[model samples]
Target: MKLANVQQPIRLGAMTLPNRIIMGSMHVGLEKLPNGVERLADFYAERASGGAGLIVTGGAAVLPEGGMGEVYCNVFLDEHIEQLRIITEKVHQQKGKIALQLFHAGRYAYKEVTGLDPVAPSPLQAPINRTQPRELDEAGIERTIAAFASGAVRAQKAGFDAVEIMGSEGYLINQFLSPVTNQRQDEWGGDFGRRTRFGVEVAKRVREAVGRDFPVLFRMSGLDLIPDSTTIEETLQFARMLEEAGVDALNIGIGWHESKVPTISMMVPRGAYVWVAQQVKEAVHIPVIASNRINDIRHAEEILQAGRCDLVSLARPFLADPQIVAKSVQGRFDEVNTCIACNQACLDHIFDGKVASCLVNPMVGREVEWALAQATVRKKVAVVGAGPAGLEAARVLAERGHEVVLFEKQERIGGQLNYARQVPGKAEFNETLRYYQTQLVKLGVEVRLGTEASADELVREGFAEVVIATGVVPRRPEIAGQEMPHVVMYNEVFEHKVKVASKVVIVGAGGIACDLSHLLVHDEVISPEAAEYLLAYRILDAKALHKLQTGKRKVFMLRRGKHVGTGLGKTTRWATLAYLKQNGVEMLTEIEYKRIAEEGVYITRNGEEQVIPADTVIIAAGATPNDALYHALAGRIPVHLIGGAKEAGELDAKRAILEGAQVGRAI
Candidate 1:
């Protein structure tokens, strides 16, 4: 808990950091909001005050064709320098060092957004962007190298303490490094040395523009995570080349945007890719930074102490809790709101071209508007149901100097989240519960567990306002033989109230069903120790390793819709479904449910009647809102409805917490 390793100061060129945790770059979609610059400044300022040693900003395009749209900051513009200065000044005021990331999307850039054909090292079409980019000609390549140097100068002019060349994550520079994208016989491609020239030249030009004294970092892809990409030896060679080019440090990024691997998701184990950084660290003389899914201070300290890398970079963790480093250093690690990496609000929002926020912390983008202020009038408030909604409402109200009492019928908090934590890979949900438990106590919230408040009692208590966050109940599906002993709800399986057999047939293919299938199939959790031993000993290859990870079970999910895992986040849905498929979970869409018997589930798929044999049947057909308390208390004292009591279409925790905060502030 002392965090000595992370607390140790590290130097990069002329700059010295107070700690090893860097707030990694994240495109928060805050640059395009109304009063965007000020909001962006406030966003970074809060994180800086919390205690990040260095903050690397989101990508700032060096060329007009390199940008995504109006959302991106074009450093070539004169106006952008003044706006960027505001961000640098705010972070400096908090005693934090900030770095600007010079970026070019290349083939990753969308023609729809930039209104121009994307350019790349070759004419290879990018799978993710679905765009066939125009190959950069000789003149275009010269201009690009010059543009990177100009961007670095602009960043220094804007008062940034450092400048990081964005060369990773399948960007313009990465495209030139990988053989998968680069196939030209010219000087820019056809060999490892030729391919690496573009990135090395960019780094050299940037260093020359900013001088040797100014800090310069290059974010390089340690593992492209794609087939026929850069090998480990090639990556190490690139790192050495970058050091020779006067780059101060190396930030190792894993995978690419077009990679099939799930780099940053809830399913990925914490600190999963630090080994990649360790390889780069061993190859380079300058400091190396490990990134991707390194969310906690303990993980960061361990990575540094293990000599994996010189520093750790955390992007989503800061979004989840701006004060993550501050709280951890104070020995309140349990109170830190850990990033679950659900991608529901952060990456998904970016992909959809909307302002990004956090599922756990909704006030991320709305910093100025949602800042907690003392309430004008303090009064007794009752928030029923100790789920995410009630817990958040109680915490916010108490923080605003209001007396709050929270009620829960169950003996514990986290209503549906309790079931969520039971699923493999979602154990991080327990952290959310732990954070609320600590905050509720610190804020002096009166939590009444095992005591469900009735509408009559709420009126009798003379509560100024009653929040009905009663949550939801499972909606039983209409099927024949529904009362069979083998049939049970999703929560029953999660709670171990009903035993799950080998062959399981689940009714519904929503997020819950997908998660249930995953839970049932994975009989035993794969510990990181076991995974490392298996790989380190060379006992199993990649294919065999994947087999061992997914346990032996037969799961069949039936749905009337075409797509499985509907309503899931864009960044997560595909990976979840792919993992399920790899685990042998059969998903049948556009199937009409016939009946559930002792034998199995009979369904009509493509007008063919067939019975899916199963030992257990699970009903994960979503839920209906539990709003009886709200109706009972209507017009009886001041009453309000939130969370599942208000709506239960998809059990959206993001909306629930947001509504709870808004309602708490309203009172």
Candidate 2:
């Protein structure tokens, strides 16, 4: 209950920390300029004011080739010191300490971004990177070591409290640490000691540059969680060597985020890596910090109580709400904007060289310039539709001291968000629901359930402003025999999540249809593992129900679009593709669906007719926006559309909520 209160301030070498919470370094890849670094003053100053005891900024490029995404990354140069100094001064003024995380991406570098071929410990390419990296030789390795030291010296000069060496996440250091990637037989390979040489040398040189009293925290991965990667035992031994090599602390992160399950990269169950932190904490006398999917403070408290690690380092969660620390300290944990971990804005946007943005918190990286105010005159505001946009608008207007009323046709507050939570690995979506519910109630918005608003009601209430968040409705396609009992809309499949028949065909390549395909293939009812699989699966299986189902599934994907897929983030889009491939989903991309008959689906492939057998056809192609209210009231009253009603986005609650909030504040 008293996690931070019980903490005695720990020392980070010469600098002292206020508490055990370390804002760990995570690259949203949101640097705005060719410089590829976030502005030090705006970002660090925001975190400092948000009560970050020690702010560890995102990883900065140490060299030109390692520059990722866009500009604003603090490149280690003399000219940047004045800017960094101004940032450090702002943080210090707010009574916060700061650190710089330095790194060279190496094989993690991309040909598209870097222009030059990537360089790795060996020729073995990192899984996510399409770029085949050139192997680093002795000279290249030495240059990298010097680059890290130079970054540390720059941090020291820029008035950073400390410098963190990022030797984890399968970067250059981990590549060398693993036999899977480190094929070199020379001085830097063949064994753990040799593999750790580059990292240890970097730490030593950085420590030497920053001096003995300066802190050097090594952010590392205890286990790569990939085949032929370093195991926990080997990583523990490596941790000891780092402590011996003069690292003041170890920030333990897990799994090569790029190769393994990307949802694990963002949305694994909370505390997925606490055990890794616990193991390292037991192995090292120095303070230990645990990261990776650590958004829940209750989970953080439990980990600390069990002595898993000395500190909780939040990445996505901090970005979701910078005021987490102050709110948690004030017992207003409910007010904290919880990260839904959708990765829609952060990772996906980064691929486009855009600044980091949170699904739930629209003001995340752009906070310094974004704000809103209450109404100058407290007028009545009516929000039609109790979905994300409606809730956000009502909450904003009410908070600004206006009378607000919210109406939903459903019995609950959440709109499409209600169904989004039904998907596997998407239970975290409820965080947005909790956020809006708390804010709406506290802000004095009158919420009415099961109330469908007619245009006349608005005029009766004399509302000065009306926001219609009328959402989308699933449109029944004009396909012949659609009324056949077997043909179902994408929403029905997702809502019921029941598996029928051994072989099925999903007729839509978009995200919703894709989600249904995954559920049917992976769930037990459809692709049971003896078998066990996706969602409502075990409900039908009465016997031979095993504990875990690792078996893959077989299904079919029918797409009519010329490009196959559109409007999805790359990593997520890739993930769905990989799953379909891994699960043996036969995809008929760019195929036209002629009709669904008794036995199978008739289609056209490359102007030729083809038939695919299926026991069930799941329709996932499109939805109709349920905007009768908006249409009827459009010119007479003010109305704004959000989510699918506005456009076909990935049906993310965070985006909906933020859009709603944005509109609400504007109103």
Candidate 3:
């Protein structure tokens, strides 16, 4: 697990990167009015200062008709040059190289966002976005090529070291490359050569605009993973054409927006798509950047040592820990916060039309606001609980030269995280827990496990400040047969404190309910250690391993709301729903919980009452704040309530961690 190769330098065209790490482009709407110029500049500069060798910015629309959303940067106008120059200048100040990713959304672009009709190779609509796009004629085709060339010229004028053309992920170039989207009989469609002509022309035009000295990277799909999409053999030919057309490097991207295959989720094993980069590297002499599910430096190093690719590109990992490279270089790998691939804040926030943030690192998008300052007066602080909130508060306070003592009632540290990791496809939570444990030890914070601190004890101990992050307690809704022997809470089942029969009915449909249903029905249960070993060794694909765990029982998930799993993150909701459907798990929504009995549970749906057979009943309605200690010591001490102790309406680790950090810095 030596990472010697990852620390080595690499060359792409005329630019010699300081290392092999590249910050891949990911859309995070940071641009605002007035001071947006400075905000965007500071955003990339932070990552540059953290020791990234090279950075590729998010998509910059080359044409108004090709814009994905209103929040994306626009390279189509001349006024954008000065605004973009700020980012390039700041990145250069940190001795970091940057590339502008020129994008054309094609059919995926929204007309509502750009106030122009979307255009593609043909009039066909994309499967994922489902927006009908106007077909490009001869004149429109020429305009698109010219627009891309103009974008490259602008990037060069802004002092960017390189420009990467977006040809992957079912965009305009991908539309022409796929027969399913481009059903035209014209020269830009039909056979492989004709289908690839659009991408090759754009590359040649961009190269001509920026000249031979400037680095030109092209991102292509190694595997489209969609119906009627271009095959790897066809993509390889397209790669050759791109190389011949003056593409200095190739970045291997897998799947598409509409692809059914799971590429980036936690269920996908780490480095699952490294083989894609290996195939492309074999076909081209140019440097190849491997992407998708690469979270650790050791994994990146392994890929490089095996000659799978020349460089490793990571997006979410940098969001989780911007100093990942610096920490690894200093031999502090255990302190690095690893991305769990939850997509709760990053992807889901972007989809919700908000600035992207991170679950583990709350200071992701708001780097300026969350910047740590030295505490003027150090005080003795007590953090009650060892959940995400308490851990973060203790870490920040200890880093600020405060004497912090973290108390956990459980024998092991991680509060609800211990139960969360037991669910399928959630072993990554352990990495977050490990990071906090390592940081606490490194910062010399006193950790007291299996110890509960009461209000009287805290007052007697004479602590300067007390942070009540006591977490939450499950709500036991009042029902007729709720006290029956068959009734149990979701946490009871996960902790193995209660036993259940094969047939189970779960009340309420949130993240907890969904996970419990999956756990109950799934046939094979793999230990976290075994799963991690398989993932590290690449012994079995996670998807395949998951398929082996066939459903063994009939489970029903009932929700009183209109939608099921409404509390789930937007990015992962689809996959979870699909998994439940595929396993024959019945999801009943907009129902009234009448009562519970030993043989079954009674529910009213659409004004009709019915009894659903169930041998076991699990309640996952919601949780309430455990604020007894805080209420008891309201005026006695300087008490501060945070995390679930403040609000526990939903399972929100994002708010819990962010609030903890905020309180820590304020104190």
Candidate 4:
């Protein structure tokens, strides 16, 4: 697809962006001080130099009470201007414009972190981050408005080209806009105008603070997907009101923490929310920026060419490849590292109170540390296994001017990813593999397919360094009757190496077990080719695909732990569990496995023995490090263990890829 419109310049208020692409704000939690200055500047500067037209820093707390649970920038004080100035200067040096997203966490703010009870439009608590928020009185509402205005002035003084008000994501302004959270009968909550007054007032106050010449962007939810929240029509009316309130531009955001709709997950199709931005763009004269799940240049171009929005905002895509825009402009889109929207590293890290990183790009939050330098001494390196870890190690070493050879026992690359791509809703996993394949070919790394080099052979080959990333092997628990013909491993089912019956019992409730249950219970076959075909044509939607289960088989997932899917990422766990329940997949947690029988499986739950009838038994009981080769080569040659071979605790792509990059750079 031609990206003529996507590469065109756009004007937003008083600012003329070099291109139509904007780096959407995402919390990285990289601040080192309350005044919000330090390595965070380095992070933004890298993206700026990489060719983003405009960079929007993550939300900075507008008030002391609005402090997020994690470390975030604070723009409420005068001292913050100096530190913020450092960031603006760095971006300016690259001729890139920047904006600060001013936010108030509202009820989402943790009392433990802020040392203050959260305040909302009403006393209603948020569904996700449950907190008993105190109702904001009239004076408190006025104070919040003033705080937003003050934050804008601070941003202006810091030399930002524009400032964006965080009126989306169920924050303070959004709390007042949504009827579900705003139950008060006061001036701020009774009618539509009353409910939207908080956002309108903040926009007006910010415009007054920054003056008409300075740009002011307001981020608004085009559709509050949560129940009892604002509708699309209401959102359009709100957009018009915001424009009248002096908002220079509108950024359309979708869903919330409490919304049932999938916003940023891999299950959601690309450009799914472009229609939301289209409605808002038609409702108001101000330019609109569309965000969420726009991954590749083709998708971004589709949204722009369709006139859905004037500009496109990408968050995770920038994390995956900071040079995406530059690469696209230079007609090198194939070289771009496309974001798979796994949310494993970026969102999961933020929730864990750690700095956000990327699964594919290890240099995301650690740009300074992971920056590549020309190696003074190049050596011959051998990377065993072709998993994510091994591919990353080989790619980095080759980029550093080292002679590298990647060996895989299988005929093709992508060790575990090959199996993962067969599961339902996991077709996006192939993008990671595709990226590695492209990089290996581009770097001229010698690839040995179907060649399993033994320790002795590697030693004789005289490789200066060896990276053993053999990944993991399924763990077979010692249980009576496990050797029955009906028993099979999860991978065996995917590989078509085993026969199964209508009734199945899967041991373990981790990610693998859940995925297997989804695969077994669904009647429709979803091959990688079929999934890609459907996605390309937009023939199927996530909602329809989720409810397409015919329940041809009865599957039981048993877990010894108290909870199921503990290994699953927080963003996708709820939806997975809901899918299993809707499809009649029985989940039994806190069960002790007694034995596997040809006819069924026996287990003990709550100190009571029970027999679950099953025609076949599948083992999803985790995995173990395939470290025998590493041990065999240890000390014989310079052997380095990475990925699952180093430690088989959880199937974390983030840890695997990061470890690979670290080892490659160090070597």
Top candidate, metric TM-score = 1
- Clash count (model 4, backbone only): 0
Estimate every model's Cα lDDT from 0 to 1: 0.91, 0.75, 0.88, 0.87
lDDT of 2: 0.75
At residue 618, give the lDDT of candidate 2. 79
TM-score of 2: 0.89
After superposition, which runs of candidate 4 have C-alpha atoms over 4 Å from their true positions? 33-36, 69-71, 525-551
lDDT of 3 by residue, 1-667 (tens): 4568988988788888988989998887887434765777777888888788889999899998897555568899888888799999998998888999999989988877788889988888776565688999999999999999999999999989999999888788888899888888889999888989999999999999998989999999888888777988888888888989999999988887877777887768899999988999999889999999999887888888888899999989989998888887777789999999999989999878788889999888677877888789989999999988999999999999999999999887888888778877788999999999999999999999999999899999988999999899998887789999999998798889998787889998888898887777777666668877887898878886676567668899998888888778887888888988888889999999899998889999999999989999999999999999999889999989999899996667888899889899989
Summarize candidate 1's per-residue lDDT along 149-236 as a digit string, tens digits: 9989999999999999999999999999999999988999999999999999999999999998999999999999999999999999
TM-score of each: 0.97, 0.89, 0.95, 0.95
| Candidate whose lDDT is highest | 1
Give lDDT tens digits, candidate 4, residues 1-667. 5678888888877788888888999998778434335578878888898778888889988898887744567898999888789989888887889999999989888887888889998888777665799998888899999999999999999999999999898888998999888998988998888999889999999999998889999999888788878988899999999999998889998888778878898878778888899999999998999998888877788788888889899998999999888888788777888898888888988887767888889798677767898788989999999988999999999999999999999999998878777776778888888888989999999999999989999998999989999999899988899888888998798778988789999988888888888888777666557767776788876665545535579999998888888778888888889988888999999888888876798999999999999999999898999999998987888889999999885666778899999999999
Clashes of 3: 0
Poorest 10 consecutive residues by lDDT, candidate 2: 542-551
Worst 10 residues of 1 by lDDT: 520-529
Tell me the TM-score of model 3: 0.95
- Report how far off residue 80 is in candidate 3 (Å): 1.7
Local error of candidate 2 at residue 101 (angstroms): 0.5
Q: What is the lDDT of residue 121 in candidate 1?
A: 97
| Candidate 3 residue spans exceeding 4 A from truth | 68-71, 127-131, 525-548
